[model samples]
Target: MQSVAKIRLADALVKIMEKEGIKYIFGHPGEQILPVYQALRKSSIKHVLMRHEQSAAHAADGYARASLQPSVCIASGGPGALNMTMGVATAYKDSVPLLIITGDVSSNLKGENVFQNIDVNAVFKPITLQSHLIDDPDQGIEIIKKTFQSLKTGKTGPIHLNIPRDILQKEINPSLLDESVEINIKTHWKDINQVKRLLRKSEKPLLLVGAGVLWSHAAGDVKSFAEQHQIPVATTYPARGVIRENHPLSLGLLGTRGTQRANYAGKNSDLILAIGCRLSERTQKGLGNAPIIQVNLDKTVLKGNINIQADVKEFMEKISPTSTKNTEKWLHELQSYNKVHKIRTNYDKTPLKPQMAIKEILDGIGSSILVNDAGSHTTWITLLMEVSEPSSLIFSGGFGPMGYGIPAAIGVSLARPDKNVVVVVGDGGFQMTSQEMATICELGLPIMICLINNQSLGIIRQWQELYYGGAFQVKLENPDFVKLATAYHLKAKMVDSPSEVLAAVENGLKLNKPLLIEIKVDKNEDIPLPK
Candidate 1:
C-alpha cells in the first residue's frame, strides 16, 4: 500500500494560507505561535512584525482596504489576542475582510485555568462575523477552509480562528490542503425593474455611493452608470474617491462634515439611488424625506423605500436604463450650488489653519494614497481634500479609532509599493501608535507622516466647546515630535506657518524616504461645518 504524505499541522496551515493567495501576514510573535512562525519561514508569505498586536490588526485592515483583497493578521493567546479587539472591531464596523488567527494553549490545558488561558472565542465572537477554535488537528484544514470561504462570501468582515499550541505540531495529510473550495455566491436581483422605473420618472435623481461600492470594485461601473444616465454622484466619507471628486457630476462627500453642495443635493433630490451605502444617521441626516432605492449585499442594512439585496457591482452592471428623464436643469442648479458653497482653504495665517494645512498636504501628495486617523484633522481632510481614485483615501470612519494612521500607512505602503503613502494624523492620535515608526524605518517604506499638532484631542475639544461650553481633559502637553521622529531615524521637520506648508510637504515627498512633518496649527481652530 502506498503511504500518504504527512505534514505538520502548522506547515499545512501555512501552506493553506499560501494557496489562498495571502501575500502578507501582519502580526507579533509569541512562544505559543512559534511553530506556525517556523512554518512561515519556509513559505513564500512575508510576515510583518508590528510593534503591537493592535497595530498588526490595523495594518491588516489597511492592507485589505488598499489591495481590495482579504488580508490576514495573527496574535498570540490571552493578552495578545485581547489587544487585537479594537482593530478587529474597527474592521467589522467598516465591513473590511480580514482573517485574524491567534495561537492558544494546548487543548489538554483547557478548563484548567492554565497560564495565558482565556476564552479567546468569547472575547472575539461579538466583534467578528465568525469566531472558531481548532482543537482537533485532523479538522484544522477543514476549519481554515471554511474560514476563508466565509470571508469571501456575504458582507465582507473580520473572521477569527484560534489554533491550539499542541495541535500545531501534530501530523496531518498534506493532500487534504490541495483542492480549493468552489464558492458559488447566489446573486440576488429583485428590485431592478422598480429601480429603472423610478430613475425614468425622476428628474433630480442622485446616486449616493458608499464604501460598499468600493469594496465591490464597482466604482468604474457606478461612474459609468452615472454618466450614461444623467445622474449626479455623492459618496459617504469612506467612499470619497469612488468617483473622481473633480468630475462635474460628482457632489463630493455627503454628511454633516461633507461639502455643502453634496448635503444640499442629498436634501433636495427627487429620488435617491443609494448603492452599497448603509445610510448611517450622519448620512441620513442630510438626505431629506426623498424616496430612496437602496442596493446592498447585506439585507440588514437595506432600509429604504425600495430595498434590493444584491451585489452593488452586479446591480450596477445589470440595471441598464435604456432612457431617462433629462436632468440638465437640475444638473445646472447643482453645478451653481457647488460653485457658490465651495469649502474655502485659502487662509494664509501666521499659525497654520487646519484647512490650509490639509489643502497643502493634498496638493503635495498629488495622487498618492492618503490615510487619516480619527480626530479633528479627519474633519479638515474630509472638507478640503479631493481624491481621484477608489481606495486612494482611507479613514477609520465607523469605529473612529485614534492612532490608526501610522500602522495603517505601513500596510498601505507594503500593499502598494509603487505608490507613496501619506498619513494625516493629529498629535493625540499620533502618540497612540508612534512606535510603528521603527517598523516603517526597518522596511524602508517611502511614507510621509503629516502630524497636525493642535496639542489636544481636537474633535473632543471642539465638541466640548460647542456643546459643553468649555474644554476639559481634552488638552495634551505634547512631546517634541520632530526630535521623536529623528530618534526613529526618519527625516523630520516642523512647520508652523502657511508659507512653509507646501514647501515642507514637497520637500518631504521629494526625499522619497520615511519622513515626518509636524505642522503646528492653532489649537482653538474648530472644524468648519456647513451652516
Candidate 2:
C-alpha cells in the first residue's frame, strides 16, 4: 500500500499553479493571503507586486490577452477583492481567461462580520463565469482543478476562487497534487453544403470576426478562408489584428469607431458571416439587413439567420471554399469608400492635432505590441494605426475601462520581453493608474508610454460638446507629466510641436527602458465620426 504524504493546502495550490504552467501572479499582498505568498516565495512562480489590487487584475487580464493563456491574479478579501471588480468585469466582458484568487477570513468567522470579510464569491458571481468558495479542505485542490477546467472550456473568461485563510493552512493529501483532469472539448459543426450554398448565391458578402478568432488561434485559418473565397474581412475592435489590417481584402474595423469603408461594406453586404464575436449594438450599428451566419462556441450568442455553435478554428477548417459571384467588383466598390472618406493625418498646427500626434507615434513604433486605454485617442489610433500581426494590439474594447494601458503594458512587457510594448493613453486615463509607473521602473520593462495630453476628458468632452450644451466637469488642470515620469525614475520628454512628435517617439523607443513621451494636443480636437 502506498502512503499518502501530507501537504499544506496553500503549498499544494502553488504546486497546482506550477503544474498548470503559470509563470507569474500579479497581485498586492495582504494578511489574508500571506500563506499563499509564503508558499509562492519558495515556488518557481514569480509574484509581481502591483501598486493597487485593480491594477493587478488588469495586469493579469493583459497577460492573458497577450499570451493567449490563462493568467492569475490574487487579492485579499473585502476591500481588496472589491477593488478588482472593474478589472474582473472588463475581463468577463471581453472573454479573457483569468484565474482570480481572493483570500478570505477564517471559515469559522462566517456571518460574524469579521474584518475584511464580505462574501467574496457572491460579490464576484455576476462578473465571473464561475465563483467558488473552497470551504472543505479536501476539495481545495479539486476546486482549483475545476477552476482551470472552467478557464479552458466553453466560452473562456475569468473564474473566481475564494479561499479562507484557515483553509490555506489546512493539511491535504500530497497525492492529490499529482492528480490531473483532462478536458475533452466536443466540437459541433453545421451543414457545410448549406453554408456553401449561401456563399454561392450571395454577390456581396462580408466576413466579420471578433475576439473569438484570436482566442481560438484561428487567425491563419480565417485569413486563408477569406482569401480562398475572395471575401473582404472586417474585425471588431478586440479582433483588430486577427486578419492583418494591411491585407488588400481587409476592410479594417467594423463599428461606430470603424472605418467608413468597413461600415459601408457592412451596410451593403448581401450576406454576413460573423464568427467568434457577439454582434453587439456598437458592432451592428451601421450593418445592413442581410441574412447573417453567426458562429460561436457559446450557444447563447448564436442569434442569427443561420447559427452554428462550434469552435471557431474547427469550423473554419471544416468549411470548404466555394465560388462566389461579382466578388471582384464588390471588393473594388468597397475599397473606393476609403478614397471618398479619408481621414487627414497631416496637421501643422501649434498645439498638435490628435490625429497627427497619434499617426506620428504609431508610425514611429515598428511592430511593437500596442495596448491602448479608453479615450478620444483610442478613436484616433483605431483610425490611423495599421495592425499586421495577430494578437499584437490589445484593447479594453467591451468594458472600455480607463487606466488600463499602463498596467496592461506591464503584463505585456513581462509576457513578451523580446518585443517592445507601447501604451497609448490620454491625460485623463493616465491619472487613473499613474502610480503603476513605479512598477514599470522597478521591473525595467521596455515600455514606451505615449501620453496624449489634451488636458481634459477628451471623449466625455466630445460627448458633452455634441449632445449637451457644452462641457461642464470634463476639463482638467493636469500635473506636469514630464516631471511626474522623471519622479518615477523613467526617462521623460514633452513634445508640443507636430514635427517633434515622431522624433520623441523614436528616441523613447530607442531608450530600451521605461520612457514616457507627453504629446500635447488640441483639447478642442474631436474624433471624426462616420457620416
Q: Write the per-residue lDDT of candidate 1 for residues 206-238, one digit (tens) a residue.
A: 999998887788888998889988799999988
TM-score of every candidate: 0.95, 0.95
Q: Candidate 1 lDDT (Cα, whole model)?
A: 0.88
What is the alpha-carbon lDDT for the whole of candidate 2? 0.88
All candidates: CA RMSD in angstroms? Answer: 1.9, 1.9
Model 1, TM vs. native: 0.95
Candidate 2: tens digits of C-alpha lDDT, residues 49-134: 99999999999999999998899999988889999888999999999999999988999997788788787888899998889899
Worst 10 residues of 1 by lDDT: 179-188
Off by over 4 Å in 2: 182-193, 321-326
